[model samples]
Target chain A: MASHTNENTELGKLKQKIAGLEKLEQQHKKVEAKLKTVNKQLQASENQLKAYNEQLRESEQKLNQQKEAAEQSREFAESIIDTIRQPLLVLDKNLRVITANQYFYKLFQVSPESTKGNLLYNLGKNQWDIPELKELLKKTLPEFSAVEDFEVEYQFETIGHKIMLLNARELLQKQGKERLILLAIEDVTKSRIYKKELERLNKELEIKAEELQQILYITTHDLRSPLVNIQGFTKEMEASLNDLKKLLEKMQIHPAEEKSLNTIMDEEIPEAIHYITSSTTKMDNLLKGLLSLSRLGRQKLTFRKLDMNRLMQQVLDDFEFEIGKNQVNIEVGNLPDCMGDDLQINQLFSNLIGNSLKFLKPEVPGEIVISGGRVENGCRFVVKDNGIGIPREYQEKIFGLFEKLDPKKPGIGLGMNVVKQVVEKHNGSIEMESELGKGMKFSIFIPD
Target chain B: MKKELKIILAEDDEGHASLIKRNLKRAGLMNEIIHFKDGQETLDFLFQGKKDKDEIKNVASLLLLDIKMPRVDGIDVLRKVKQDEFLKKMPVVMITTTDDPREIDKCHELGCSNYITKPIDYDKFVAAIRQLGLFLLIVEVPDLNNMI
Candidate 1:
């Protein structure tokens, strides 16, 4: 019985040893699978970190490019402002000049080498002193756009104490804390002098116009009586005489009278007689026309719708005598109409047509065409004539008084002047277009 | 063309009228000459709304006119004569010292036959009157019965 019990105990001990070895093998396999999974996750996270680092580096490069472009644009703008050949200066918040162009130095008659570290008031170019200019700049900076011809005036002995127009504005930036003022100066001495001269000339012209009017009246009053007496004596001699021999004998007794009579038959007497009548007639007409012009200036215009073709036809009728004499072929083109004056406008057409007839070259066929069109706020009428063309340099001067291009034509050179005055009275403009052989086209614009 | 010829002169100035009549007589034309001093008497004899037979017998052939005269102007007489059908054919000459071409042109346009501006000197005045005598030869002066 003792031998059987000892065998069972040995078998139990052997089974326990086998079970312990199997548990040890299973634990070793579980640890190896976890170690493989952890190694794969670590490799994925390291690859993602490398890509993120590259994205960060690219963003930094783009920021560097943007900063460089902005800096280059600022430098370019500053250099462009500096390149101008006028006196230019930039000041900081302290009222001291931060920078100045070479022109500023030259205009002030101060050397840039000497003025580099100096204040703005130290330079001779300043009209308003630095303190006043700074105050003006501060007040004007916000509303400078509303002001035109704004200037700061002061006297400077170094630049001969002339007037100046000063312009100033401040430059603002988001990143910069300090503001800069840019000042520009223009010398207006010549313009001021020119304005004074123009005023003086206008006053002189007014006096001259009055004097001419007085002289004209005096001349007409003095010339009328003598002309009437001359007509009376001529009629007496022709009557109660019949013999050629007696006439010749009587002529022989008065040698000087014969010479004078011969001259009267030739040129001077005929011309003098014609001129005297014409001068008297012109003065009367001028007085009447001038009164009309002045009246028109003061009164408001009454505008009416007009037919350009009908108006032109009426103008053509007033020219019947001239047309018959010259045998001219007048043409008309597409005519347009708008709201404007009728009577004064009629005078305008008459003057133009008369001028066309008067300026015609002798023995040459005459041609005149009227063209008209509608435009914005106005309409245009053109009288194109193939009579004689004006010189290019003289075309602009034709509208002024006493500017006669042709002396052979009889006029006081007042017709075109009257036309111009009338046209301007209508708030319009007139332009002359011509080439040497092509003749002239005078365009008239009358506002609606 | 030869008939009993007569000329009547009416002038305010005696010197101009006498010299004029003398120059005409010296031109070798034989005509009965009568002189008057003003337009009133001349117009009365020619017109005055009366047509007497004996008074018409002394009617002259040519009428010399001046624009400026007392009582009635010469232009007024010329106008009346021109409007009168029986007297319209008579040649009227306007004589003056003014060299106003406009007035001359106006006179011509008004149907005056001829015009002459007088010479300033006396001798030239005679010469001018004599030359006008030659012009009268060219222009026809109709008889009173034939004119009507």
Candidate 2:
């Protein structure tokens, strides 16, 4: 019985041992599954961390590019402000200068250190604080969003007197940002002075012309009284000489003495009287010409549309006797109409035609051509004559008073002067082209 | 019988007055000519009678007035004479050196009977004086005292 009890005890011991071993194996498998779950959670956490790091690096690179672009734009704006030629200023809402262009600093004679960030009125010891400027900036600019050509005349300390035309623009900002103003300055002092000088010269010229006219009128009128007396007294002396001659003829005297007396009456005394008479007549004609010339300034001009063809025909008809005598051939071309005084224009053409007739070359049959057409601003008429032309030396003096080209000619040197006066009165211009012994041409332009 | 008509000549220049008197005599005008040196003298003779001259109450007279005189002018004399009751009927002729048409028109507008421009040429001046003499012979002279 002892042996049987010992065997059962040993088998029961082995079974218990085997059962413990199986339970241990199951616990080990459960530990391995927990480790696998922990490994999966660690892999998920590593992926999320990598994604956050990549996002942070990308954001840093974008921020650097944006900063570079902002810096470039700011530089571009600065370059634009500096490049303008006119003095330019950028001001804040308080009218304090934010920045100034290089031109502004140079023209105002102010350094950038003293100019920038200072109130515009306070700059240069308050020299820019002008009433007109204050009115424009304070009152005019706010109502008008933009101000153009706001003139301010101020006495500056450095520049003396300055006339500035200010143009301002309000640069509006969004989101309640500080508003700025763009001020552009133009200096018009030199141009204004030049204009004033020109006006003064014009007035002085007008006064001089009026004074000349007055002098001419007074001189011509005062000379006539003495001329009349000289002519009348000359006639009286001639009558007295004639009476003395008759008395000597009736009385008997010594032959030699009578011969000398007759010679005195016939040759010397009569010759002197004849000279006096002719000289007086010539002086009378000259005085008459001067008087008429002075009167031309006061004559009323009646402007009318003139038929140039008819007028030219009338002028030719007036010269018909001379034309026939001179054997001149006149060609009348198509003449354009123009507005002018009738009597003055008639005188102009008459004088020209007469001059042509007088200066005709004897060797050749004289040829005169009158042609006209509409020019750019007026009517242009050409009077071309194949006649004795003026010498180049005398050409410049032909329009002056009492300038006669040909001494042998019968005129008193007043014809050409009258022609010039008539042309000036009509506000017309005349140009002459001539070569000695070749031909003469007159081109006249009269406004339509 | 008509009283002999007396001619009153008003001139400023001595030479012009002598020449005019000679020319008028040559024109066969034998009428007595009374000369005055200036417009003032002529006015005094007509308005306030001269101390040495007879009273001009019944005198039949004609006036030849020259313009451009000292103290007073011919136009003033003409205006005053034309305004007067007795002197207005007396024929007045304007003789002047000025040939300006405006002065001639002004003389006519001021009631001068005739206007004549003195020619500088001696023959023309004699012819003008002769024409004036002939006109004076034909024109009827009004007595100053008889006119209203």
Model 2 CA deviation exceeding 4 Å by range: A1-89, A100-115, A123-129, A153-164, A171-179, A184-198, A297-302, A305-338, A353-397, A431-445, B1-148
Docking quality level of the chain pair in candidate 2: acceptable
Predicted candidate 1 versus true structure: per-residue lDDT over A203-287, tens digit per residue: 9998887666555544442343243333323333233222333565565547768776566554665566556555544554444
Give a tens-digit lDDT track for model 2, residues B1-148. 1448888989887777777778778877888889998888998889884443346765788899988778898999999999987688888998877665557888999999888877766678778988988788788887776765
Q: lDDT for every model?
A: 0.69, 0.84
How displaced is residue A42 in candidate 2, in Å?
Answer: 20
**Candidate 2 colliding pairs:** none
